[model samples]
Target: MTHLLYGDRLHLRPCQIDDLDFLHKLWNDPDIRRFLFDDRIISREEAQSFVDLSIKSFKSGYGLWLFFERQSDLVAGFAGLLDFSQEAPSLIFGTNPLLWGRDYATEAASVVLRYAFDTLKRDRVIADVDEPNAASIRVLEKLGMSPARRTIVNERPLLYYEIRDRVGN
Candidate 1:
């Protein structure tokens, strides 16, 4: 069983203690945070704690991982299955704004979706997107996820989407 996923243009590895600074910068970037966390900036200490949890999640054999460009080895995005003991795993993804429209997010997400359904044997995976995030909503749709409902989360309207194992096995 491969722990890390490799794609034509990118690779993924579990977050490490060394990744604290990267996550810190990622979560705080104005362009990234605006959509990822509603522009709320996190302190370095909070970033440290997040990395610690990521490490713990990695130790569990599954969790969030960082995406890196294969050639430059630069962190391009973050994605993975967020179990959270939910009925099914939650799909999460974020990519650098500078690299937008290159299909990196979709490709990385395809890899994670395969891992979740085929490798992890998950029956389904779900994603919750803010209604205004048309780009993300399109990504999920391109991944074959169907919008299931509309609801409010954190006082923001969201659209829920889900995709089942293609074979339904």
Candidate 2:
């Protein structure tokens, strides 16, 4: 697997074809899907398609990753930059419900944010969190991102957070 970024407790790597099973398990978790799109359970075929599409997107330097625990190498969840547009992008991240409340999301997101600004040289990055998802809001704030705007996604109100590259100071 291709390692994208690593933190003290987690390492983010590209999702491999063999990761379908793990991805399926993560996506199907009830709590994991709670803040996501309607708690939809995706089929194996859908999971495969998602992985394939993500792989294709990775080639262009935009896609999600299979977040792994650095100590045990257990698949925790997915995290990375999602391409919202050529000029605008969003930070994508989530963890298995079992791993919730452990700060893994914050750790992984912090590393990716550094990669976005320092490595990719992106001017800014944004994240849309469901208004009621307190955990997600905390993660964004922990990474130095501040509320930028509010918008509706899929008929649900969402809060957008943003962080920009700080080249000096």
Candidate 3:
């Protein structure tokens, strides 16, 4: 059975193949696509590929999770530790634009980070945001992630951030 994760206001489950349509549409939303996929439209095939990867990653103890409002069951967003097998697993998250400023991103991400550091025994995680993505930068900062470095991706200025598991053994 797929595991479910919960936050104070959101409940999350491993994204399934059936969710590809929702994910594709959410990712392709003009307000959202710019912060991810280098602002390119996410094709259904690519979304399917990502769901496939999430399924595989679950076996290894980390992957993508789609979150929903606990009371209304409204599908809010997603959060996950991507590239888990790498030396530094990176964090990824997004919410419907209508849900912005509601702390859904932060709450969902907090659950993923706990799973990463506590359940997966990871030491640190990284995230990169387009320089203009102030909302995401704020979410990472609220999670106590600090600026690590800067780089360019697809000619877009990106700022990377990192957070170590301070509660490490």
* C-alpha RMSD of each candidate structure in angstroms: 1.7, 2.1, 1.3
What ranges in model 3 sit over 4 Å off? Answer: none
Better of 1 and 3 by lDDT: 3
Superposition error at 22 for model 2 (Å): 1.3
* Candidate with best lDDT: 3
Instruction: Specify the poorest-scoring 10-residue window by lDDT in model 3.
Output: 81-90
Which candidate has the highest TM-score of all? 3
Q: Cα deviation in Å at residue 154, candidate 1?
A: 2.2
Better of 2 and 3 by lDDT: 3
Model 3 lDDT per residue over 1-169, tens place: 4668889999999998988999999999999998888778988999999999989988988788999999999999999988944569889999999988899999999999988888788899999889999999999999999999998878889998999999994
Worst-scoring 10-residue span by lDDT in model 1: 53-62
**Residue 49 miss distance in model 1 (angstroms):** 3.2
Candidate 1 per-residue lDDT over residues 82-115, each given as its tens digit: 7655688788888988888988889899998988
Clash number for candidate 1: 0
How close is every model to the real structure, measured as TM-score?
A: 0.91, 0.90, 0.96
Error of 2 at 42 (Å): 2.3
The window of 10 residues in a row where model 2 has the poorest summed lDDT is 80-89
Clash number for each model: 0, 0, 0
